[model samples]
Target: MDPTNSSTSLAFEVAVFNPSIIVGPVVLGALVDTCLFGCLVIQTYVYYANFANDHRAIRFTVAAVFATQIAHVMCVSATLWNTAVSAYDDPSKLQMLPLASAATILFTGITGALVESYFAFRLWNVSKKLLLPILSMVLCVIAQVVSLVITVQAFKTTSVAEFEVDQNTPITLALTSRVLCDLILTLSTAWYLKNQRSGYLRTTNMIDRLVLWTIETGLITRYDERRRSWRV
Candidate 1:
């Protein structure tokens, strides 16, 4: 092959691969997260407006969701931009952006987990032994630790290139943590619902269903995986 032709072909390959690296996962992840958060906000407000008396818990949950949304956007944007730039230039510029994004995401994850975990505890309050509830709580804590460690480590590294190449490891770990946390809470809530006494009625029922559905959509829903298959 001619040297000039070879050089041009390699350049074209790098350009194509570089943009794909930035656009593919980052865009999909951002869109999914943004839409989910928008739905969360709408559902949160509806619940809040319906139950004006129980504003404290609703408000706190909404705040955490909003914070998580903001962090998600920041991380998504920064990551894509950093990835795009790093494709052609020195990788050092991406240093602090990932760190900051990671911190925000960690905060969001922890706060959100706490909200769900607290609600789970409240539901299981009547349990005599509390063993199941305690175990659920421990799972949430451990999941949070896993998420924090993977996320922070992924961000703190010098070159995001390696992190991005091996992105599945951390992303899978983080998702696993989120899923496990949600599963434990969901199961606990289901047990609570089954064991709920006759005295629970009216708005309490609605609240239970609403919270259940919210967590269901945010975590357990297979919408993204389906989309991935369609694209493939």
Candidate 2:
């Protein structure tokens, strides 16, 4: 090949692989997250509005989840703008914003911890045993620690690529742990609830519905967490 042609080809490749191109996908992911959060907000509002007669604890949990989700949405938007518009036309400035990124990560961890612990509370209610609930709580703690560490490390690094290269293990493990914990909680709760069925047609049907609801929520959230972590 001609030397000049080779040089031009190399330059083209370099330009194609700029940090901006990589950051584009992250921005898109953040936008999608914002949309999902909006949906969550709407759902929370409707639930609270319609179910005002629910237990105080249930209402409080719903409020807390929605609140944290709002915080996460705000932080993520700020971070996206900081990494995109404010730093536009400059690929080197494609760095993560420390405050926004950190806050977003912390919010996610707290949200997951809250969700898992709440279900652990349910498990406690069913079994009256401390061990299972405590185990689930421990997994949540570990997952959150890993998540926060990944966020802090990402901000400290120069680019997303670098962060992934350095922290991929923790990233994968954190998500895996989170999913496993949710699954365990889901299965255990469903099993215990199933055992409570008194064999009467009406009561058995009600228990079946509860089991279905638990499985559905469990799988949906588990899938969502996996998707979010993969994006990160």
Candidate 3:
């Protein structure tokens, strides 16, 4: 526990609390996320410059998305710092504090919910119906609530494995809801767009583009879900 020992004793070797590939992958992922966030920032700038000039609501949505993503990236960075440096020597520090995961999970859930809700709004606009969109929004809200519950359970549990076991029900519920929400949003949007396909070449091409965008968004959501569940 000596302050000087961290510098001399644990400086050269991987601590028992962490694995070899751990920090590398986290740092790499953080870098990738930051780069992607930068791209989002640029896109936000362009949207503000071009699209935001006319639509007040769209501009607000764009800003909300950007801010939520920024919060997510910042949480990711803080979690990395906690894992990589704060617990380098103190094994006790390696134990879950619940704060880090709590903040990150809450932020992630909010971001995912916002994105899905936006897509659901788009679908509602297209379908001119409230049934499916309302369902999707409800699922997204449930998932976010379940994520926060996981955070609370993690705080109550002692170890990571114990936390996972204790919260398995809520965890599975949250993830399942997320996946289902994504599927619904993607499929519904694509189906709606497909239905819009008319003999008119220009309109059909526009629907095609919208369908592609919907597919891409779903793929990204699936990837994020996998990454969240991949923890040891």
Candidate 4:
């Protein structure tokens, strides 16, 4: 490669790696997640606030739920910021991208799993009838870990910089775990809402909408999963 041509090609790559373009979506997603999770936190607090005879466990549960959501939002935002800046700084460096990508993907899945576990706890508290939800969540965790291991192995391929990762690698694992987690959480909420001793209309509606948004965000609808969607 001619030195001058190589420099020009590298400059074009830098220009295409504009931080603003990709960062905008990340920031937007973070804000939307914040809004949804924040609303849930407030809703949970209000539900507990009116408890004239609140148990210690209920209070503790409320606190744990709030903390989990906050932690997830913060982790996601931090990951986005790190990934965006690193990409802008060195677009051609696959190693750097993978570092941030792996962290973001792993933490995001873990956060979602924790959220599902919390909901599972709530389901068990509400009804002894459905041990199935908790079982499903446990199975999902096992599957997610297996997928993550495969993705890590794929990244170990020599000259990953020249090799584009298909949707079947780490990204797929992350999204699959995320969707399954959302499904578990959504089912738990639906079960609770249906079986509530006295339903609160506002809270039920909010939970429904939030879970729907979660499903939409977590599931990669841009590509068809039923068909193998990849080009490399």
- TM-score of every candidate: 0.59, 0.68, 0.70, 0.48
Return whichever of 1 and 2 wins on lDDT. Answer: 2
Q: In model 1, which range of ten residues has the least summed lDDT?
A: 91-100
Query: lDDT score, residue 120, model 4?
Result: 69
Q: Model 1 over residues 79-198: C-alpha lDDT tens digits?
A: 666655553476435322355456656766676576767765665665654766677667667667767775677567544444554555766766676677677767767676676654
C-alpha displacement of 22 in model 1, angstroms? Answer: 5.2
**Alpha carbon lDDT of residue 84, candidate 1?**
58
lDDT scores in order: 0.64, 0.81, 0.77, 0.61
Give the lowest summed-lDDT range of ten residues in model 2: 9-18
- Candidate 2 structure quality by residue, lDDT tens digits, 1-232: 8999988855654554457555677699798998899799789879978999998988898889989998998898888887778778866566433467767877898899889989999999998988888888888889999998887776676544446557889989899989989988999998888777544667879999999999999999999999999999
Q: Could you tell me the TM-score of candidate 1?
A: 0.59
lDDT of 4 by residue, 112-155 (tens): 55566666666666666566566757756765685566446545
TM-score of 2: 0.68
lDDT of 3 by residue, 34-126 (tens): 999999999988877777556777677778889888887887788778767886786455545436555667777877887898899999998
State which candidate has the highest TM-score.
3
- Order of candidate numbers by lDDT, starting with the best: 2, 3, 1, 4
Q: In what order do the candidates fall by TM-score, top score first?
A: 3, 2, 1, 4
Q: What is the C-alpha RMSD of each candidate to the true structure, in Å?
A: 19.7, 18.9, 19.8, 21.9
